[model samples]
Target chain A: MDRINVCIIGSGNWATTIARNVGRNVANSQHMEPIVYMYVYEEIVDGRKLTEIINTTHINVKYMPDFVLPTNIVAVDDVVKTARDADILIFAIPPTFVNSCCKTLLGKVKPTAHAVSLIKGFERGDDGQIVLISQIIMRQLKIPCSVLVGCNLAHEIANDNFVEGTIGCRDQKYFRLLQDIFKSATFRVVVTDDADCVEICSTLRNVIAFGAGCADGMELNENTKAGIIRRGFLETLQFVDVFYPGCRMATFFEACGISDLVTSCYANRNRKLAEAFVKTGQPLSELEHILIPGHEPLGPVTAELVHIMLEKKGLADKFPLFTVIYKICVGDQPLTRLVETLRFAREDM
Target chain B: MDRINVCIIGSGNWATTIARNVGRNVANSQHMEPIVYMYVYEEIVDGRKLTEIINTTHINVKYMPDFVLPTNIVAVDDVVKTARDADILIFAIPPTFVNSCCKTLLGKVKPTAHAVSLIKGFERGDDGQIVLISQIIMRQLKIPCSVLVGCNLAHEIANDNFVEGTIGCRDQKYFRLLQDIFKSATFRVVVTDDADCVEICSTLRNVIAFGAGCADGMELNENTKAGIIRRGFLETLQFVDVFYPGCRMATFFEACGISDLVTSCYANRNRKLAEAFVKTGQPLSELEHILIPGHEPLGPVTAELVHIMLEKKGLADKFPLFTVIYKICVGDQPLTRLVETLRFAREDM
Candidate 1:
């Protein structure tokens, strides 16, 4: 059999950082193809197209500035052109682009090609239900779509720091291929069959970051901050049990679960923005403009989305932290009294 | 039943800090007595007896200065005197004092009385086996002993910031009593039937804090820090499963398990000292003298104790993080390469 052709379907900072892992691992793997085709959205940076810059210089100069990607990795401008011949597709684009991108590649790519989405938030369906990005890809392209998520910070991974992550794949054959394609000395990969739990944990972590940021912004005790995080995790666990059932409790112990939540809570744009929102008494949008211009923090946005789903299901009170996060984001709840909010909110599970 | 008579053992900062919770809870509790007797080892603080200062001023001057304990918390220097008529004994003294203190209270307290140890470290039995402090209390005094552990930082609780804890009570009747004694608006109490896991989590948290502190000290990125804490918790989960079997994975989700670990990792003397050990090339004792002056950090000490037991049982390699921590403390392993140690150690179960 021919070696597995790998295609990375995004060129953002995370995508570029992960392309380093995927592109480099192909050098040593016997079962993976040598050339990795990375899809970079056509953009002009400094009078050069982004794809041309990445392909000629072996660096994602615009998204991931200084670090170099593997030499064998080729860059392509058209999404369909890059994905058409691949057997393993890695989706790391903004979650909003997943549906359209998958639609573009629907009949273009091999039906045997499976996907692993690194997208980190939920997309809403026409029925107003939350949909996993991998599900959208699988539904559009008729292929198995697993997910990869964990405490992997792009800059840290770029610097070659130790990182661990989980791959949620169901098939044993694909698991070994993925393990061979992504595992490196610094990047440890653990794969589980609970794909939905992996994606949900990645999505809900941003919401928990809001609570952790509020705790930090209020200068509440470490006890309260830790309690909010624990309670948020408990609520997420219950949310999985209620809506996305049949996942094991052990899945919550993986890198995609508690590790991702802890990393986001401690240090992330969302937590930082939430902290600024508390300290400056400004709306999240205003804080985003001032603190991190041009980029929006997703904590408050995800909070609103999760809140909408919970409210529609008539279970808003079931997740007090998530509800309170949305309330605080919208100024519906006074921030001053929330120093003890999660403490009194019955753990919300 | 008549109101439960309460005796608090030890009058250190934590003891005095917790006395505030016990004393305040009594005001709203019908099952508890109005007065609490706290044991204070005889000492002179600034020309006044420590017990006299607490009894007269409603404050523990040497231990918890400037904070007024509830007036109903009376202080006495005699251990047996405090325990003689009590029905709920709160043992918050240092672990070194547990054996002798329990021996003194043997056959002196009411036969119906029970214990709840606030100790955070392990005790070694005659065979060098690690023993829970509650086990020693029960063995010495022939009374049932439960435990209370969580992210309850003493100063934070004293300042009236929100706090949460778990009461590892096996008996439903005692659970209600403990729930009454520890619960407050700011002090939320969660009770679990798995007392042994709760106690083990409390004890092993110190060992994990060393890994966290080491990560921070080395200036490793947030991804690595979160990974270390997660791996440490994973090792602790496996540790519980091996020696103290039959505990649920759900118990580790409680305040005593992950919350306590997070709190200690982010902010505690053990974490602080471990960071200092990495920054300063001096020994732990030298760093303790410079930073904390009179008190010793327990993380390294507990690491050594746990290492001894694991070595005796031939399970040293099964806990890579714990073993590396002990090796780092004893200078058997270079601290530098540990940046990638746990990452490559196969998640040793």
Candidate 2:
């Protein structure tokens, strides 16, 4: 076995916690380089540069103040410099920033290098359709890309609580190495060949969680909320089956699918925001500004983008949950229609 | 389209709520007889016979005094008399009483009749393994049996709130008839051909829910609870796949699977009791007596039976959540071991 170099491509809340894991795992494992390069955007925090602060204190002081990073995780201000010598690149930036980040490292990276995406939402494509972040990374860098997604809460995982993640690698050749890089005593990993299916679920689950939030806003019974979530999952199944024809249905059973979906429905920020949106009778714009200033939850964002493609395909009526969530977010429809739309939709389906 | 008679074989909490749906659906469905007979064990409530009270007031005053049964549902004291003239016999009794109810109706049921079971737990078979209640009904009555199960709460559905149910009917010929007898505007139904898988999920999910309950009892983080649930569900998949092959993986995504499991873990008696068991340090026996006397949650009951079979098969370690939950229930292990056992079970599994 040859030494493998790993580089992390972001410095947000999720990225910093994952860096601690990647750094510690690489250090203890044989035939893997100890130094993990993490690309941090240039930021001034409390009269010091963020990258400089991390390099000295080994802590992501701005994003995750409580979590201490591994000493081997070196912070680099330049994206190209961080990824230039790496054998494995981890793209953990937000979905909206994936394209620019990919472009910066396009020709500088090794041609033999492989990439794995931990991005959770979708990016709007040039054709006005939603595109997976892994697809963007692969298309830009000309390398094979895999995905990792699950019920991971950054603060929880950073605190050494147990978390389960699914690695969707279409190639069996990448399984052992990816597993070694990600799996730990508290972080469990499962590999699946259904890459596209796993990635799509990460994007669609937020829309469903938003719907669950509206139900909570109305204080519906447990049975009714569960019923609404069930229908939303079915619609997600239909959406993926129709668009990604070759994706396996069984992949939806993986940690990236139902596990992530249910966890988000229960505790995701989207659920809280949507609940406030309905209960306070305030638009999402106002609620986002008040509750989480300048930060928009992924549910309404994904719903809006997904609704575009659904309408273009002339199938908006078939996906009632997404449509209702998108409409409610934009003030086009009332939140109460979620239950009615789900009930009147094809029960025999 | 000959007139079809529908018989409900119990008057318990869930049975009474379902009888309300079965009664109304039978009345509006064409070619179905307007009369629905429900078998009720004779009991005196407030010095009045329970069956006579149901017949007079169209309500099971003892079991579900708040729900109003449709007028067409006539209550009968004799189980045999209630099912003898029926074309579609519905078994809604608890798993423990399924055998006796089947024995009473064995020779009296119409030769051409089929049955549908709404039972949610498993009974110990003569061979010391857990047996699906639906299988017992089918074998004893000499008729094909389907199943209806989901995230249904008795009071929730009885109040006309929306609910989703999965009907695992392997026979396409019986789909139309079963759908007509069960589906309503508020009670939605979806049919799956994986009959045994659906039936086993109704049993195995209880064990998983018990694990979730134990996780809740510890006040573990939401991510950890979801991961435990995800692993418990995977164990459930492996349990069904190893013991009962030919079960589709996609069926686990249905209402009978994840929807019901999440709902139960969130609000079912099992989760509540387990929480009490941990917080108060009292054994389940004492807790059940103090909280709801004479009522035992299905989670531990099913866990005890499933553990026997798993241990007999020499694969107890593979299903750590079930084993831990069972051990915790019977005082063989402390509840604190739940988290440590889960963390050390199998990270790369």
**Highest-lDDT candidate:** 1
* Candidate 2 chain A: 10-residue stretch with minimal lDDT: A340-349
CAPRI grade, predicted model 1: medium
DockQ of 1: 0.71
DockQ of 2: 0.55
Each prediction's TM-score against the native?
Answer: 0.96, 0.91
Write one digit per residue (lDDT tens) for candidate 1, span A9-90.
Answer: 9998888888888888897778788999999999999999988998899988888888999998899998988999999999
TM-score of chain A of each: 0.96, 0.96
- Can you tell me which runs of candidate 2 are displaced by over 4 Å? A1-3, A347-349, B292-294, B333-349
Q: lDDT per residue, candidate 1, B262-342, as tens digits?
A: 998899888888898998878987888887664557788888888888888898888888999989988999886566566
Candidate 2 lDDT by residue in tens digits, B1-349: 6798899988888888888878888888788899999999899999999999999998888889887899999999999889999998888887778888888778899999989998877778776788888788888988989999884576778787777778999799888778778877777777888999988887777777767777787878777777777777778888898789999877877778877878887877777788888888887887877875645577787888888888899989888888998999898998778877766667333
